[model samples]
Target: MVSTVFYVFIFLLALLSYIFIKRNNREPHKRLKLPPGSMGWPYIGETLKLYSQDPNSFFAAKQKRYGEIFKTHILGCKCIMLASPEAAKFVLVTQAHLFKPTYPKSKERLIGPSALFFHQGDYHIRLRKLVQGSLSLVAIRNLVSDIQAIAVSASDSWVSGQIISTFHEMKRYSFEVGILAIFGHLEERYREELKKNYSIVDRGYNSFPTNIPGTPYKKALLARKRLSKILSEIISERKEKRLLEKDLLGCLLNSKDEKGQVLTDEQLADNIIGVLFAAQDTTASVMTWIVKYLHDHPKLLEAVKAEQKEIGKFNDLNNLPLSWTQTRKMPVSYKVVLESLRMASIISFTFREAVDDVEYKGYLIPKGWKVMPLFRNIHHNPEFFTDPQKFDPSRFEVPPKPNTFMPFGSGVHACPGNELAKLEILTMVHHLVTKFRWEVVGSESGIQYGPFPVPQEGLPARFWRESSS
Candidate 1:
């Protein structure tokens, strides 16, 4: 009886302390005219709960309970979640000047002080101009022979009836494309070395910023130094030799701003690595899903194959690569890609912090609050997309409602390499489906969706080479 009384007394004291702390924190922010939403616990916030749930369901539940626009504390910041395309445009496109890109403290620290994705204002515009032009449709056409060679070689490696992971193969293929297009052709041994270190740096994006021994973050920083050293040596060699090849890296090296200021070696390396990092996994994820989607829907698979065959008839099918004009001929392929992008929702949202006190539909979004425009919500909304959950590429026969399809994001902060990503996916998918007929070799429930969609089993499948048949 005495021990039970002691436990009750302890519980009473804890409950009183929680009430007092809650009341204290609430008193100060009363004058801020904040949006109608909970701020959650101080400092720790709602990160624990948010991280534990599937991202799609978490956002859906919140939107259902709190309405289209609501506020919550997540990732240690007080954030406003905008769930409509109109709101997305207002925040991201219309009144974009009122906000700036804001990421978590851990993410910022991992990306470092010089990561180009964090750039804002006039500097972003100028730096973007330097890199964006080369990834355009016109520029991409110039490098088709190289991209085609790599794609064909990579696709040819899967022997008939062998159980292989399409997801794994695509990851390696995307990395190879990045290496050949960005750095020119390197020896297979050197390319493997760069790939090994890059995988290390990639882990840091989702890791804590802690620098203790044995931490992923620490290993990533060390790997970054090695990668930078490799890039710097290549730059030095090109400078000494006066090399000018028709490649992205070559274009970057020769580029200068209007002021005639060239990028420092570090800036060049950061951006080159940035492009590689950006292009690889996201495109690979899309490619993996396309394979899964096509296999699951046989009619769509045959349609894509038929489209490629029709285009192939006009070209030197054996030696000639698909030109920009032939690529444009695949309208069915374009629809399929858009559907995959929407269904997969590769990037979930774009987060920007309010620089000043901002108002949206009379709701006060105070200074320093994170403004998140949710791409997934808009893309999956039934109103904008009928039967949003269904995988039907025919919907793309008509364009999506404006601001609704943001697979690569939109506006000033849009991904400059989006055109390149689309071109790569189209090229890779075109080659794979035309050359092979495949079937799933494992359970389809293996898709792990969160942070990004990944096939847990690497999407194992059996390959049947069309030529062999």
Candidate 2:
């Protein structure tokens, strides 16, 4: 019996070794000639290098060494990182359907199969349409008063001559605004619970899916349960009331398919959670960056303030008595917001998975492989914007090439909330500029990059009332 067991163990080891060798030596598909890249060894091919200390710098070095397109493996999947304008446009616009968001396992683990981000093809399109009407220009105009009220309340809490963390404040403001805009209520307790749940989900982004006692995934799972319960309760309440308010949740509940079919309760919950997640997290990060930029550069702050002053006071912000013609005239505020987005992008890279083999610039991209268009590369490309790192609003005055500056992405999946996000940001910053004077308390480099780069430490700033009263 001992001899037989030994022989079996030896046979299994040999088979595993043979399989590894075969996988490594497999030839590239005849029609799929991938871009040039160094794939080091089997199992752990270039993954460690790709995820090194500074991935952005690493990718930059690789781009310098090996032109626009390069192949690498990440999270056990083969991927090509596309950098050039033509490649980005092709992936984002021309071939968008071929490439869906590439994080199914993560989405499933964090928010379950029902989440809109996990859906593809017709399901995704349908859900997107249902929510799009809420973020339309008219819808935003309707919500302007709510947004301004939240901003003013947040600002009122700030004490002059005290060092405050703008990041936290921005998170609270944006969270409150998102809740009011979507659900039409300012439930503080629910907002607090949702924030805690989202933090767990955020931390689980790059973690292994072992739901063991101390794992991030475990915490994320618990958080998901809490979030889903809250969302379900809200949906139930809305259904019970059957009120016909024009908020996002109302719009979603009322929407129907061409055949008059409505979304399942599960689908509705998932989508509402998706919208809240998207609107809150990224907007908070963007707001933090905008405040940091203004603090770091006083001159820019003055310009933004002057523009806001021209628009009128806090009371006049949501007053539609102010015309669209008048709003269009605030060029400086518009330019400042554009430059802030360009400099401190909220999303570093957008992921997509190829559905089929495709050719680009003499390289064959295989199906099921992930494609990442690094927006940072496009935003900071020297060829498109001279001295790209320099914070210059004038660059946006005359827009660059088609795909040069895509902070909101491009094509159908481009953030539908872009206009509302811009409005929230501009309104908040305008309030800050008019209400208080703030200065950066530390080195600009102190700010760090997470999934989206935000102040590593809460952006601490010392505020004093502006004297120009």
Candidate 3:
């Protein structure tokens, strides 16, 4: 009878334990709430609302209503938008491991799956180090003269009185600079081939991803395949020559994993294309905005011009190229670059996917939800800048509060080509202010978003080379 009583006691205890465990598991779900915002229509879920108006307005409206951390569904994914510096830091830096970088499958296909930004952990670290090393201040400083020469050549093309799309021209110039960084100096035929095919890819980058024949995306896919063939031939020749150069291509060719495995040729090509894509549009957009901003703010433009022309006069007297040292010391132009990056905010936000259920300030970000750190919103916030909408470079006389200025982004996945980009911008600015004069050809003062915010119709303008007196 005692044994039977003990058996009954054990069974009852086990039953109670199971119930207790289940209730505790359910309790957190009961208590944790999703951030507050509308999910919008069923599967479509606010996608139309986002694309229907200025994206900035959409995000700003959301922030105004729901505060910094809020929930919304767009592009068919539920997302948590973080606009505050602390929130951005939490997602991008301190707690980055919990959020993996995410991109659409279509984009990955075009840019290549192995490109640096699409990765995490060791693979990302390895690629980033290689890219950063190749574009480091040490490496790029050597290319100052080469970049200046390219800037001069490009500026020579803009002297025609005919209206020119500043952004389009800047894209060409930045692409040339990108080519220089990647391959040192490429053959003209190869350069032309790349320019031809890359133009197709650029046109289709934001197009609807469909396999329908004759569509822009289809042409882009074909061009991408052709680009691979061209890259393969280039790689074969480099191997035949047994060269040990230090350009980005060389760095990729010579990289080895801990296991002594080299990156595949396909991987090499993806990153090459990725670097070109990275270097071109955003830099072009920012440079174009600088042109517009300088035109719009006469006093700031005159100040920048004065600074650049002084450097020009010195270079002319010494018969010396614009040295890297000179580029570093352009306080006025540098401030303008900083202000343009802030006001334009070309890379408005970046996307990361939650790897697990994560909590931020009592809000639950469920696994697989998209998390966006809205850099543009933070940039335009009045708390951070006195007159957020004004094109005032003087505001940059003092350094911005930490985490508030992330024009190049922050954390591990931040852009590796940023230094090269700034160099190109500064070089271009030096050439423009000292050698050329331009006038906006039309009265249109609106902005257009061809993925990045650019002035209307690429800021059509007429250029005239400043005559030597």
Candidate 4:
């Protein structure tokens, strides 16, 4: 009986030894087998070069050398650039469940940690649905008149002979619309104060992510703190009054998640700032580009004018606001905006992280590695859009392939404010084209696209109303 017990103990010891040996002998996570590319220097690998003076040229050169999906370290993460429609769809749609939206440390810090822009998974879906419910068609339709008034008011401020920076003008116009639509009307001083603060925040997104004294990032944080205090005051006043209104702030105050929990005061503040920044910066950038492009191509300008004239025929262009249906029906306007979005590529690249070690198109994307959808490269790919660099709005007359035109990205993580952005763009064009005739004063200094697309000189131009001229 003692011998039997000893033999059993010996057998258990042997099994344990074998298990430990196997673990020690196993390979290290298959060595990743990442796509072909250099990792550059230890840290800050290719980050400066990627965001250099001519980032677009750098990307184009890299793409020419290394096919679509190639690995490189950028923005403190080892990432792969997905520059083809197939890759975009694969990462953003077909196998989307395996990827989650991500942003660089800089973006997250500037946009706020709790902003809806950073939410992922079920929370993201819930947030998007709640916001979408508030930004309903009827709500947007109601905003058209106000948007038009702001656009026209700003456009009128451009004296006939004065050489104004179209970029600056568009920025003021878009920001004002956002302010009014979100915070309600206020004195000009308050409007300018908000604009100044938001501008600081916007500039920080493009600046290097440093928080030392006098750094843009530091100033931005300070501005954010001030802005937060301002918003908190507004929220306090609104809560005390218990006054229900229809603007963005009001809708958000009443917003509730799928679980019926209302957004916290801080969450609501972050989103309000985020929405305003997104609306003002991107919409203004695109509209400014459209003006430059249209001035460059007169034939297309005339085509757009014709479309606007037709739309105006249904209602007095001077007094009556454009109906929602009329704005969507403007094909020429739609094509023009699409072409601008493609050419300018306001959002050059967006971030996604692999949920696991993913094998896509025979290449391994290791878990936690970022997959950057190269929107600008795909928009300029000749295979997808013929003569991709040329500003031909007609290319959009017939829609491109599924994932070919991704100005707003694709799949579940696409920009939730895309439709609202479109509405804002259309409104700007409708009002500007109908009200004024403008000409470019200086040749467009090519786009500067580090964080967002904007002309180097801000597209200085001369504009005058038809009646005034």
Query: Which is the leading candidate under TM-score?
Result: 3
Weakest ten-residue segment in model 4 by summed lDDT: 23-32
RMSD of 2: 8.3
lDDT of 4 at 448: 64
Per-candidate total of colliding backbone pairs: 0, 0, 0, 0
lDDT for every model?
A: 0.81, 0.77, 0.93, 0.81
Candidate 4, residues 149-227, lDDT tens digits: the string is 8877888778669899888898888888778767677557666777788888888777877879899989998888878
Total clashes, candidate 1?
A: 0
Name the better of 2 and 3 by TM-score: 3
lDDT string, candidate 1, 238-306, tens digits: 889898866677887898877998878888887788778778888888998998899899999899988
What is the alpha-carbon lDDT of model 3 when measured against the actual structure? 0.93
TM-score of each: 0.88, 0.87, 0.96, 0.88
In candidate 1, which residue pairs get closer than 3 Å at backbone N, Cα or C atoms, i.e. clash? none
Residue 145 in candidate 2, Cα distance off native in Å: 1.8
RMSD of each: 9.7, 8.3, 2.3, 4.0
Model 1 worst lDDT window (10 residues)? 106-115
Q: Identify the runs in model 1 with alpha carbons over 4 angstroms from their true place.
A: 1-32, 105-112, 160-162, 187-190, 313-319, 467-469
| Candidate numbers sorted by TM-score from highest down | 3, 4, 1, 2
After the best TM-score superposition of candidate 4, give how far the Cα of residue 92 lies from its true spot, in angstroms.
2.0
